[model samples]
Target chain A: MAFQIVINLIIACMWMFLNESYTFASFVAGYLWGILLLFLLNRFIPDTFYLRRVGKVIKLIFLFIRELVLSNIEIVKLVYKRQPQFEPGIFMLPLDLKSNWEITLLANLITLTPGTLSVAIAHDNSHIFIHAMHIDDIDESIRSIKDTFEKAIMEVTR
Target chain B: MIETGIDITLNISVSLFILIGTFFVLSSSLGIARFPDIYTRLHAATKASTLGISSMLIGTFLFLYAEHDIVSGKLLLAIVFILLTAPVSGHMISRAAHKSGVKPVTANRSDAYEDALQKHRKNS
Candidate 1:
């Protein structure tokens, strides 16, 4: 991925030098041209094209933002309630993610989204403990996490 | 600084965003005061505060761009940095609290971490 980015940037710079135009527009055009060139030559590359990963990353960001907004609204409602009655508990989440960074990212996203905070991880990286402000049904909450954030993360990383 | 129609519109929107941000931040503080346990308090402190600060920063960014025609990269960077770091800090605090055996106020359901720890000890 780094090599591909370096090649694209070099192409962009060479295009700017060749055209004698050091403007942002020319650089963007050159970048687009580089993308097209790379797309055409993608078959020869061993790994998947970098733009696909970039697109997946953008999708993950949108997914996160959507979750954040929805949960924030929920938090607002909970905050203003006259008599708040909710079950807050700690539960285990068995992780599908491997690697320290992936687990860290998952933990961060869970905490950032309102209502759920990741508390700790198992020594073998098999499970994460989460403390949620409201868990109507433990199984349901676990499934939602698996479906939304976990699925989106797996799509991006794997 | 100009009193153009667009400038007025921008000013209104900026104020609107800041107002919303302040409301969330205030409610989050209320949450911290009212919540019974450390874990519940963390939910309020981390999530609401994050959205509140991000909204305020965005409003500031828009205001600067509209009034001065200068995009402030620093404000944008600050928003990103907060979004990135707030969760880590929240996680660290919660983990520390749990490790030190600070039980939650109302855990109607099972405490999985404590169960796991007991199971680990038995195995060892």
Candidate 2:
């Protein structure tokens, strides 16, 4: 668990430091020290860590990227196909996986994708209602999201 | 002559920072517009805006550092405060929205989390 936490912290630092705008010696010093402490503690903690199915994650990411690119292209085409008829509405999608972090990631990913946005997560975490940009066939849209995107998330999180 | 190079570099960085900041702000707005609903919109706007404003503020600080002295440091301090608060506020807003019966995208199987919430509500 500590190792996982340390890795997460390192990831945060890496993300922050990538910009490298400021020249604060103290900031850099503090960052290094925090990382070192986390690393040392990580070695001692025995926490149940989810071993990501790497091959699955890679495959899913690839599939997601493909779909994302395709989704964007389709959205652009729809926009350009004059006389745009967007029959948009809210879709209530049932959540399969229950992990809070997993659900959060899934929702964020949906938001990032074109044409679909995760509007609200039911307080019960049972459903995630999304507002579709154009709901021509809500069922079809749900099927695509569930089969393609949400399933991939299951593979990663499970 | 010595100050000329510093001034030009500083000007360029300032413009770049401002441009990036503006882009982020726009992106956040776009996120709000294009995202599905309130919760999603909040997430998109908050994430993008934080990064965007921070970049702009950082750029501003750097430009100020190069151009002036001392006073600009105060500006950096203010930016730090904003960076600290924005995410927290966004989280609180989203959580409140969620608690007030905001519907999420419908899920597939049984939701244990929802059961817990329901039970808690009942007991209380």
Candidate 3:
């Protein structure tokens, strides 16, 4: 990750030189260009896992954004309804990913979304505690996270 | 005239983003006030407010870019910082709340932590 960031910065600088603008847009564009370039050059790199998963990463981001927007709308409705009904609960989520980075990213993504927040991780890293605002079925939420968020992350990390 | 046309479009879009962002923030505030417990309130403050501030910053970024052609890396930095720190802080706060003996209003059937704590107490 650190090496990738350095490469991204170097690409951004090169982009500044090419564009001669030295602006933020150019830098972001350059960073994206760097990512794309690295992605293309993944065959030669030793760590092919992360570079190859760029598409999955982008998909994960889009999924998060869509969920974020939908959740925001739900929260708005919840706040406006005459008698708000929130069945908030915290449940222990058994995790599949073992790495620290994967766990952290999963937790962060959960916390960022609309109704759920990741509270803590087990000492053994086997499970995470999540608090959800409208959990009708714990099994369903767990399956959803595992299928979408956790599955997407596994594509990147594993 | 052509420049004015572009300006008007930018203005409208920026305003729209701002409006959406403000709406989220307002809902979050309502959530904070109406929610019964600390855990739920944390949910409101962290998730909704983070999105709200982020959307507003996005509007600011768009306006500045449209008007001045300045790429404010600072605003991007701020957004990244908020995105990274906000959830971590929320986790810490909620963890603290739990550890300090605050209970969730409607917890599910099982708690791994409670079981672990009991076993440790029995051993000690």
Candidate 4:
């Protein structure tokens, strides 16, 4: 548990530094801010972590990159064609992972990919409603959102 | 002669990048205006702004380097940070917009997720 706390604090600092340029002094300020943000947000998120989970997190990132390239190609085709082929709709995704951080990460993945938007998470964290701009079948949309994205997230954060 | 030509090429590239950045910012704002709903607008805002900001940052960095002798390492830090942080912040914003009851443009079928969110409340 203590290990996870330290890891979480480190990640928070990493995100903070990702925006602000590095000076030793700025980093110290970021570290303190990260700690404060983490502590404040901790109430909503699960406060546990494991080493194995980190490996899955790495895998999920690779998956996201693969999806990103393919989706960009798909969007280009959609735009270039004379008629826009967007089969726009919303996907109501059921959540398997309950951690606030994990759910937020999942939302980030969806938004990072083109043609999809993370519209909302249910109050209970069991559902994440997403809007898809290029899907035809709602069931398939849900399946992809579930199997393609959420499943990866579930395995990693589990 | 080669060194001079290289410098000239770099100058052209930096100017081109700035022009492209301006285009991105224009299209994204256009998207925000033209798109019908919150979700579509979010896409326009995010995709366009990221591209714009990234290009603009790179352009500024190159300009600084070429004219001011700025080191590559420091400029690189700026580029990397923008690339990483923009998407994450964009994601967080879109999620907030979605949760605020902005319905999807479902011309025909019933949305399952909104229904599901309701169910999440019902079950618990």
Clash numbers, per candidate: 0, 20, 0, 2
Per residue, candidate 4 scores C-alpha lDDT tens digits across B49-102 of 665666887888888888878866765687657656766676667666656766
When superposed on Cα atoms, how far off is each prediction in RMSD? Answer: 2.0, 10.5, 4.5, 9.8
Residues A93-126 of candidate 4: C-alpha lDDT, one tens digit per residue = 7777778888877777777676777766666677
Q: Per-residue alpha-carbon lDDT of model 3 for A25-77, expressed as tens digits?
A: 99999988998988788677665535446678888888877877677776777
Q: For model 2, how does the per-residue alpha-carbon lDDT over B1-124 read when each residue is reduced to its tens digit?
A: 8689878888898899889777776766765666455654555554556556767888878876776664576667776666545544654565566568765433242223345467768988
What interface Cα RMSD is found for model 4? Answer: 3.2
Strongest candidate by DockQ? 1
Sum up the clashes in candidate 2: 20
* iRMS values for every prediction: 1.3, 8.1, 1.9, 3.2
lDDT of 1 by residue, A1-158 (tens): 88999989998999999999999999999999999999999998668799999998999888777877777787788889989776888888999999898899899888866578898999999999998776667677788888888888888888
**TM-score of chain B, candidates 1 onward in order:** 0.92, 0.82, 0.89, 0.83
Give one digit per residue, the lDDT tens place, for model 1 in B1-124: 4568788999999999999999889988998898778988888888888889999999999999997999999999999898889889998998899889898865565678888988999999
Q: What's the lDDT for residue A38 in model 3?
A: 81
Q: lDDT tens digits, residues A1-158, model 2?
A: 34665665575566457657545664566466665655566546465432335567888667744654454444444434446444455657888879887787677566545566565577778887665555566678778778877788887766
lDDT of each: 0.87, 0.62, 0.82, 0.68
Better lDDT candidate (1, 4): 1
Clashes of 3: 0
Better of 1 and 3 by DockQ: 1
| lDDT, model 3 | 0.82
Tell me how far the alpha carbon of residue A65 in candidate 2 is from the true structure, in angstroms, after superposition. 24
